[model samples]
Target: MKDDRCEGVIKDAWVEQHWGNPINRLVTKVEACYTKLKTWNRTSFGHIRSLLEKKRKLLAQAEALLMTRRNHEQLRTLKGEVYELMVKEDAMWHQRLRVEWLKAGDLNTSYFHSRATQRNRRNFISKLNGEDGQVVEDEQKIGEMMASYFSELFTTAAPSDLDPILQGIERKVTPQMIQELTREYTAKEVEVALKQMKSISAPGPDEGLHALIKQAAAIGTISGVSLCREGPKVTHLFFMDDSLLFCKANSHECNSVLELLEKYERASGQRINQDKTQLFFSSNTNQQVRNSIKGRLGVAVSHQFDKYLRLPSFVDRGKKQSFSYIRERIW
Candidate 1:
């Protein structure tokens, strides 16, 4: 009994640490079992069944880890974590079944089986809420609240000035601004813009472009460049080859960063192509990219907000062409 309890505790710790990551834990367990089997020279069906049972128990234990603590508050916290894990597991198992079916040249069988499994899992989860009427309703309310909060917080705002700028550019350059100029810009233009921006924003010639590129190349090497709830959320600012600034606030930090960039552009003779700028949410790829450029010149890197930038896109060209050819043709 003590041994079982210890096993349970260890399993729970593993699940908690992994945030109930089943597929990865299962793979690791399977690998361990295979290693043991090889050592023992056990190649029987019974051995395989035993290994499978052990893996299943590990997965069950992981699920059980989420099932502990029955209080409303505790359950609410666990519910979110468990739900995310379940979604991830569903995706993973579906992928696995598809791969296996493809390997066996039984695509139809795999598809139906995966679909059925997913349906059953969903049903089982729905049924797990027990007969407590209030619990179910409360949980639903919490879920709705979370969804609404995320929707409000992460929703992208439409650029208020974009239309006017495009119109002005259309009047100046291309006639069919929306249609013709959309595809005109190339990747080369983006590269050039990045280079020019870095050069202008960097503190010195030695540390400007070269240092920024190096930092971008070796992103993970830097400390303090991650998303943390308590850390400064603001990111560094970039302008049209003149100055870089950093800003920090509790929220909407990306806007502050963009504002600084715009201010720098206005101070300098350079103009920002607002239509081309994009805001990248801080993900693994983007964090690396952001870390690489942080402090290259005067750029400050923080986790305050999502990345925002104006880059050259085909839309501006289209707007120009719309003004040039389409409007002219229509007029």
Candidate 2:
């Protein structure tokens, strides 16, 4: 980017053309500039590795010539050329590795190159489990599977009983909160938001799916087991699509919860993976009740639940034991 020849190519390609939308005009200019830059890089720079090697060989010859003859100017020119190529090589590897904190001019090209290669190897998918539960190794099939999976994951489903669901949820947002949220963005606020964002961070979906499920529990559409005599009832705890549901050890409530899940699947186009889902029962609950509920839900039963978000779902009397993972991570 600092090269004069590259700057000339970009400037030449970025010539203005008439377009109605300013954004479209700008995008067109950028696309043209990128096309020209790629051509310029290929024709002029060639492969960085090969070019660097060629420059090193020439530099070695210049040094030998200088040792015998008094050609100081030629020797200095060759040294400068070699140094420039080395800098470019370092930059190329650094960009691929994306080590933002690593300072410029440190010349750790070999380390960056190795890390980049390792990352590419780790990210490469050789095979994947297809929707049909068979292992797929074909590259094209794997690509299609991934594309279809993510397309469904992020796409919003057809509208469900959203209006009734929203109505069921008690209004918690005050007028002041609404006003503040709806107000036009100020320059200082925008600057603060930009500063708070990391280079790799971007906006994602907010948490609201739990509200509908909570409303269902509140209205007794589904009965949730109590944590304690005074504590609030627990219907479900949700983080993104993952959920942990709690209810009394009875077939009726289990069936009700399964019905709700079916409705959710229909509305959201997201099905629960029964293979990954498990039901954990309280110690006091009878084995017969557990078996009946498990049969109704069509999910396996487990004596204990796995950690949610790397933390134990239920914390007992021994706090240190429950949160030992945190201490281990810190250490």
Candidate 3:
């Protein structure tokens, strides 16, 4: 309800009201059962089962009585209670089942129940495909495989000549483009961005009051930095502290893109963590080509990739494949 970070912070009552979560209904159901079970003189499983049956019969009788009486106020109260119970049940099943992308709604409890089971099953990695074309089922061996794979991935490679590819391309960025890209960050603009972020993301944030000072300093540094994409025709995406650069696979294009990144780092007093950077190769790119690309950028090459923006960036993303993650939310 209250936070040490900021005075009079977000409270559970407000969240339950605004978020439309059926907290009261859930408590009503579970608390009654918990209390009844606790107070019972017997402690055996058989007695517990009988107690549960008794509770259900009592609820059923109460419902039947309210229906037969047909008092308008009673009917309305009972109807509202039943709806709340339904909502609470839906929310419970959804939470327990761990449905990531779907909200609790009509008739999804049964589906969520099954997905929870599937999630549990899928989490257990009984086997893994090793890079050496060997099946590794042992947990220790899987750990070893991952550690070794990533070690080689982040390690710096021997330098190779990038001059050949750099010579092959013509410059697309001219003086006008350079002038536009050279736009600097102003303190006023930085303050506006910080204020906007505070309003939207400050309440019930990841880390509470203690993080305010840290966030201000970090965000201030971030605000002082600015980087625009190479050309108006190019598409560049930025999220959080991450940046993604898209360009032609050719070496000239790659070199140009890298150069722009380097310039941005120097200008903004920020640097990219090359050890964590990765370069994904197309299916058609041979080992020799991939190696050359990695050498130039000092980035690791990855044949397989995972989700970004909750969507998979697979090597062979076909029309059907592109929408596969969407199917997960359909339930």
Candidate 4:
């Protein structure tokens, strides 16, 4: 973006004659500028990885020559060139990972590369379960399945009145407040709001879902697992959108949990991603009961849990032994 050639290309593309409607005219300019930039990037910038590798190899050769003969000036030039390419490589990975917090001097190119690769691996869906309880592996079939699933999931329905449901809830916002919320905003306000927002941020927590599950647990509709003799019964644990629901190994509670999930899906217009969902049971839970609950939930059973939220999921009596990985971490 800071390249002089890039600026020239953009200026040239913008000056090109094009006649169209206002929107089309704007799009044409943008498309032309994008094409020019793409070509410029290919020709001038080239591949950052390949360029960085070449620079590193040259640097290594320079260092080897320096060891045999003291050519300080040549070694310094190669070092500077390698450093510049390293910065460029780091910047490329930072943009790919969308990490906004990293500063210019933090040249963690390899770390960023590994993190981006890990993210790609974690997000890629090689297979998907269709509605008919069959696994879909074909790329086209998976795409079609996702499209169909999301289409039905997001299809809007007729608006419904909320007065009856919201009547008992205390009003936090007054009519005047509503007017303030609905009022038009000036350009300055929009600019300030946009500037204040982060490049990426986590979504707000859903307290309503927590309330609904808590209500179910309160009414004994769903049982929770008790960790110790006197510890509080943990019905459910939530972090962002991922949830861990604890319930007894029984058919009745399983059905109730499924009903609650269905209600949540209907209300929120969001369905659970079965690909990432899994069930873990205590050692005392027999194979027969595990199989029954697994069939009912239609989620895979996990026999081992390494970590959740960067901490060990299951800890032993010896705290030091359970937390040895903490000491093993790089400083």
Candidate 5:
């Protein structure tokens, strides 16, 4: 009976091993099928090619679906984060505006002091003559006296309550009135007005010459003026003069820098002769000259100035167009 029981147990164990779990058996069968499919070719004796094509299509679809879902979830998360940031930024801006309004209400004493000082200097220079040197004592004393006089003048000044003579002057020369006068005046009228003005406040020609000579002498005495900073270190770059005022971050950056420089010149009462300025950038290896320039303050380098042997066919247009025009046509 014991021997019979042992045999039955062995048989049961073998059956269990052979059967296993249905899920595990299915997985093993799938793996075997995959391996066979991978190894199979035209010589294989199964429908492996058709089966592989079907499996591949199914896998591709599954992967595409997963990718789409992931991208959607990521985009939603980013949008929510961006919205939160914007709300915070708006709150900060509102807080800043309130602070600015409060600050604006306070007396800006430093601003007034600097402005008053500059105005005093200007007025002193306007009225000053060499004969008044004794009255001023010294240059430093003159500056202090001018400041004090201006301070007193400002203290005594009334708002729109000018003396009749000053009021008449204001009535005649309101900014709008001046603008209208300017519009009405012809070149001949302007010339006549200037002549009358010069006659009324004329310095002798000798005195004018002496003043100009003094100015020249003063400028000549300024011995320690320095030049602008050194140019950039890029190999393919060149500058026409010592004006390191321009920058070339890239093609776009270069254009922007040129525009900014032009704007600055307008604002600062300076002029830029673009005809004299040289701009350089890398182009195709076969292009002619490494540098080019444009006439006047134009930022667009002329095609004629470009020496690149492999000049793009589209660059022949005489009119200035966007860089995109050249890029699209060339590349």
Candidate 6:
């Protein structure tokens, strides 16, 4: 059965004109109602009490309105509108509270107050360390200092061409990825993509990489190899059959870890998964060493990050608070 609240059925035909057109659930009056509801004063107690009364009245009016629209095609829409408004109240409060670890199903003023105080302290930028051994308290000077620091950092001349750095690296895409990419896509794919896309107000970034790398890397036959100063070593870890050959940028002592995947695959039927793999490069490794290892393993690039599984994978001497999140960060 069709979803009653959804809009626009997939047509029995396809055409080039449909390429850029947006799909639905199309915009609704309920969405507009939520928009208006959000503009009401929520900070003051008296105003919020009045707003709650107004919301109650609106809900009552909506219930009455539903009866009148029941005989028409707008009956389902009426139900959807009321449901959205009911849910929107909690969502609106949750947005204002901004407590990442808490949900909005329950509302209390004390919890919100504590969260607000925490946010204020977290965002307070009272003083900044200046370049020339001075404390910068002035907001304008601090802003200028940060701007200059970042500008110099980003615009620093490239050490060398990235292509050369990546030249000897192995192919990141796999056969599984190729198969997925070459397959014909239908309306099902389009619908799934639309549904998975985050809303405009979502916390994540606007764009995400939608590469077929997973499917490509999932070929269970492939494995990785590595060489350490002690000797050759292979360590390819895979949870399922999806083998993402993640090569962590480890000590220059090892040539490649994928070699271990090969060793493991040869010794056993299992292949390492690249999806769970994270490759972090070290600063001390020679360029030739990187080129050799990357060329041998088909790894084109390395991203340096200090976290692995929410734990600090690398140490920072400057800030004690960098690792403090680990104490509280749990699923």
Name the top TM-score candidate: 2
User: What does candidate 1 score in Cα RMSD to the true structure?
Assistant: 27.9
At residue 90, what lDDT does model 2 achieve?
73
Which scores greater on TM-score, model 2 or model 5? 2
lDDT of 6 by residue, 240-281 (tens): 323334334443324323433343334333333333444455
| Predicted structure 2: lDDT | 0.75
Q: Tell me model 1's lDDT, rounded to 2 decimals.
A: 0.42
lDDT of 3 by residue, 1-331 (tens): 0113221122222233222357866665455554544443223232433444455565566667875675666556555555554555555455546545656455345667688778878787788897678999898998888789777654544324433334333468999999987899789987787776622244331211112222322333212113355533323455665556555466765676565455444433345678767787657778787777788888876545566666665635375767765787796
> On a 0 to 1 TM-score scale, where does candidate 2 land against the true structure?
0.59
**Best first by TM-score, ranked:** 2, 4, 6, 3, 1, 5
RMSD per prediction, one decimal?
Answer: 27.9, 6.3, 15.9, 8.2, 38.6, 14.0
Q: Residues 1-331, candidate 5, lDDT per residue (tens digit)?
A: 1123434443443344434698887666556554544444223323433544555565455556766566656455545544443333333333323332323223333554455456566655523333345544477766777787556544522223223213222233588877886775588986686776622244332112122222323433211112335642321222332242322323443344444444434333344554445454425422333222232234544344453334432343454652455677879
Better structure of 2 and 5 per lDDT: 2
Which of 3 and 6 is the better model by lDDT? Answer: 3
| Descending-lDDT candidate ranking | 4, 2, 3, 6, 1, 5
Better of 1 and 3 by TM-score: 3
- 24-57 per-residue lDDT for model 4 (tens digits): 9999999999898889877766777787788889
Q: Which ten residues in a row have the lowest lDDT in candidate 2?
A: 159-168
**Per-candidate TM-score against the hidden true structure:** 0.20, 0.59, 0.34, 0.55, 0.16, 0.35
Instruction: Rate residue 154 of model 1 by lDDT.
Output: 45
Q: After superposition, how far is residue 264 of candidate 6 from its true place, in Å?
A: 29
Clashes of 3: 1
After superposing all C-alphas onto the true structure, candidate 5 shows an RMSD in angstroms of 38.6
Q: Where in model 4 is the C-alpha error above 4 Å?
A: 1-93, 105-177, 200-207, 225-232, 329-331
Q: Compared to the true structure, candidate 3 yields what TM-score?
A: 0.34
Evaluate model 6: give its lDDT: 0.48
Stretches of candidate 5 exceeding 4 Å from the true structure: 1-241, 245-251, 283-331
Q: In candidate 1, what are the lDDT values of residues 1-331, reduced to their tens digit?
A: 1113434534444443332478887776656554654443333222433454455565555556665644555445555554444443444344434432333223234565667677667655332233244444365765665577557554544324333223222235556776776867888997687766622143433213223322322342222232466774323334554333232221344343444344433333234443333333233445554544442223333333233352222233365653464456679
